[model samples]
Target: MRNDEVLVKVEGVSKKFCKSLKRSLWYGAGDISRSVLGLKNPEKLRKDEFWAVKDVSFEVRRGECLGLIGHNGAGKSTLLKMLNGLIRPDEGRIEMKGKVGALIELGAGFNPVLTGRENVYNNGAVLGFSKAEIDRKFDEIVAFAEMEEFIDTPVQNYSSGMKVRLGFAVASQMEPDVLIIDEVLAVGDLGFKIKCFNEIYRLIENAAVILVSHSMPQVAQVCRTGLVLKQGKINFGPGKVSNAIINYFGIFENNGLNIEGNRRGEIRNFKFGNNDTSVELDISKNQNQPEIILENCQNVFFETSVIIEPSVENFSLIISITDIDQKVVAQVTPPERMFTNLTKMMVVEAKVNSLMLNTGNYSISVHIYNKSNAVDRGEILIGIRNILKFTVKKQKFVGAAPILYESRWKEC
Candidate 1:
């Protein structure tokens, strides 16, 4: 229980992979043959061999959580395996102290033929827990997993979700010195995911937890220290989780705004920032869709900058939010907020205190219109058709409607 205790330490650890199956088998055979003869190959490259993780290093201390983030083949999984001792590093060393509980892969260590209840006891025994200890914790794991009906079923018969639930339940119950969870939690339902999050947080007071995830917000929430990997290289060192997240986003410089039509005004920028972090379109530009939160802890606001040309008027500002399928989730038109006359150039902004939308990406279109006219079908002064987007990431009330907080969205 000393403050200087380091739970997990990975220093200069690296793993290599072969591009061709034939090369991999040949390399394995050569290495095994050399080991039997007490001989070592001096040549480093054996054709098609490349480092999946090269010279990566980090430390996770007790009571601290570390986030590992990157793209699909960023070596995060390989590093996790090294931490769990499932694979040995091609070079360097990994020092891990105390009992480690890892939910690395779905149903990784469980026997397919054994019943869930039997596996629970067997795995606990493998983890150095006595029979009596497993007996005492068996029911709690089952109840937390909500898998009492299938507790007696064979492990092979359980679905992915069921296996993940059972795995997390077991890991969470066991107070290990280190808890490592890869992308396995992404398969579970929303409620279970939230529950597991809370459980992991509680464990943070005593154990060091390592989380590998592709979701930025999830990593930002759980970990204080961050490690970013890209193509087997250390891109960003362990630092503030927030800054690491932005670095991991790989967005630099102002990628021009998406706009269309020769409208009355030139929409220069549509950006958002708050007291904590500011994502300006001029600097860090998001992808096709951005996200918004309603009165969340972070003070977030959206500002629209535009330059009006000459004298253009009698057009209403129409803003519409639609889903991917082009269905109008919410539509609002501020009646009589029309700019009847413009002197030279201007910037107009419509700010919302807070909003609550569904988790999916919602496309936003800003348009200037003058009520339906007989001469023309489209009265768009300037139409940025689905040019920008926002996301509502909070998943809640899954079985019911997605549209909550009706008051936030002014119904047409």
Candidate 2:
């Protein structure tokens, strides 16, 4: 591969599908008639056609790992298929700079009847590996997959995890010019998933990779640039991974795609408390303290945005804090605080001063409500929940709650 040339160039790619099987039948008939007439059907005749992918174009340079992210059926898989040559675009072209090895599906090229050893060679040969090359890398593939004992076993008998491991091992070992993987890491155990992630990162450092995953954290850690896919097209990306994640979720949330169309807004990037030790006041140390008192209730709340139903208007999220006994300690209404209409994620601080309580183990409950009352969501106590817990030590205080104030006696 040249040092400065683009590895893959996708230009004006679009894929369309007929809505129903009946429409597809008509499409076939139209194609036959057009072929016989040495002409094509009028573009208006295919107006009923739905575009699964629309006018998508991008160029991937050599040695760049690009992330493709979207909800299910968002054309991400279709785009990958086009790039892998498994499917052709209805309009436009994809130019590859080198041999493309795509693990588009687990056991995609493996023969069920063939032994693991045979399938490896079969796939390797198809991937343009020489016989000697396959032989040299055969043991390494088995070792990396940790499937040495199953080498002679027919691939059909291997478990799904084993198949994934072997497929990844074989594909990575062959050193393809470009590797396109589609959510393969979503499967497998945690240990194997971590191993796969590390291996993919290593591959990115040396070559180009297109990673597709449902986990945002995984993508944020792996890719520097990402493409967000909307309904059936590559929407927007090439920005921060967090933005990509928010965009990916926004597509569904805006479309009323949640279960039963509950139409609840999303909670993004929630950090429970401050990291400093001083900020994390542990009142638990004072068993002598009669009541569980939260020293600093100021630093607790789930911060996010709220989108109302039907209108989908954005509202600043409101949070209310309660004691383990379901006592409403403090309520922070964003609208009342002059923070009503929020177009994006905004930071809000909730504080409860002078929390009086009888010293005992207590829990915290959280309630989230929209400004319009269209959505009211709260976390119910299953057993004992942890939001904030602090103990009050018995001291020379007059009030039932712990409070300190300077007092002086003067002659009248």
Q: Who wins the lDDT comparison?
A: 1
Q: What is the lDDT of residue 302 in candidate 2?
A: 38
Clashing residue pairs, backbone N/CA/C < 3 A, model 2: 289-392, 290-359, 291-358, 291-359
Candidate 1 colliding pairs, count:
2
Model 2 C-alpha lDDT per residue in residues 56-123, reported as the tens digit of each score: 88777666778898888888888888998887787788898766777888778899999999999998
Estimate TM-scores for all models.
0.71, 0.62
- Candidate 2 structure, TM-score to reference: 0.62
TM-score of 1: 0.71
